[model samples]
Target: MKKRNLIGIVLLLVLLLGILPISSLALDEPALNSKKILLIDTASERTLIDRMADARAEPASLTKIMTALVVLDAVDRGTVSLDQNITASAAVLSDMVEDGSTSNIVPGETMSIR
Candidate 1:
């Protein structure tokens, strides 16, 4: 009975040793933290650097230029004309003043394009 118990303990140790190595090898690789980015030279029309630039958090105000381009295109296509006069009613002026949009247009003022 003593010999049987010693043999059982040795077999258990051998099984645990075999399983430990397999589990260690199965661990995932460490994650990559770095990302690649591009920098361009406007005058040369080429890539100045092909490396990671400063990390940007979020895109802000990037579409404003595109919005301006679309509005200009609409005006150029005659969908809008400079001769069109816009009157600032009390409601429009109040909203502009409340929202703090840049313009000196007063209430009840008539505005025409130059």
Candidate 2:
């Protein structure tokens, strides 16, 4: 009877240990240390958290988001297909090379949409 009670106690402790961290995580909010941050709920159009959200900063790679949206919209409208081939133009290749960007594709090389 005591051995069974000991095993039960151990199992109960293990269960509590596993659950405590997860419950703590659900209760706690993470610390954000960024100049600008925005968290929104798309469903309700609610802003959950915003820190310096209005401040405009230099957008270096953020332009990629617009590019992706446009590409996805085109794909959705059947204007571009995934299997369609795109050839790298000489101007594009030269520009990329001059900018010290690395690419697997050579000039005039054809690649699939993906």
Candidate 3:
């Protein structure tokens, strides 16, 4: 009877230990606190989460997307080739340095579009 009770206690302890860690590892949904937030599935074109998505708000840092789109369109139209080499201008380098952008490039250095 003593051995049976000991074995049962050991088994219960092991089961709780295993289940507790797994339960704790479960991810909680993120709490987004912003004026407007939009989460979309790019592949499916599905709006997963939309919080005032349609409301016109000042585009801050969103201009990068527009710039990228323009560049991509230009590339597609054969206006800009991917293999084209670009030399870093002094003004551009100065701006990058002032903006504290990280890069291995130096002023006057030439780099090819990848």
Candidate 4:
């Protein structure tokens, strides 16, 4: 399997097994670092743990993972290549937050998509 796919599976497993189990075990206890978190069983479509599920918060690193997944999907479909060099344009840099996490690329720096 591809490395990206393996990484995605590993992340999902860590969420479903490592995090989800501990999150739902305590309702009276209030201890969490995430602004928004939710775990829903895909087979049954049941929500297991929901914390601030309706709140709108900046995604931070989650967006990186999501972008990787989308790009990997495109690569699998032959729509995008891992060797392609992507240059960050001004419009892309315009979305950056001063104190928040964003891609480590500058507006002009170019690097392989991989």
How well is each residue in 28-79 modelled by candidate 4, as lDDT tens digits? 8567787678989999999988988999787767788899999999999999
| Top of the candidates by lDDT | 4
The local lDDT score (0 to 100) that residue 78 gets in candidate 4 is 99
Better candidate by TM-score, 1 or 4: 4
Q: Of the candidates numbered 1 and 2, which has the greater TM-score value?
A: 2
lDDT of 1 by residue, 45-100 (tens): 99866555666533335445665577578679988666777677887556643545
In order, candidate lDDTs are 0.67, 0.79, 0.79, 0.83
Q: Give the C-alpha lDDT of model 1.
A: 0.67
Better of 1 and 4 by lDDT: 4
Model 1 misplaced stretches (Cα beyond 4 Å): 1-71, 97-102
What lDDT does candidate 3 reach at residue 29?
A: 76
User: Model 3 over residues 52-102: C-alpha lDDT tens digits?
Assistant: 999977665665677568877889999988778878788866665354533
Candidate 2 at residue 8, lDDT? 100
Maximum-TM-score candidate = 4
lDDT of 4: 0.83
Give the distance in Å from residue 107's predicted Cα in candidate 1 to where it truly belongs.
2.2
lDDT of 2: 0.79
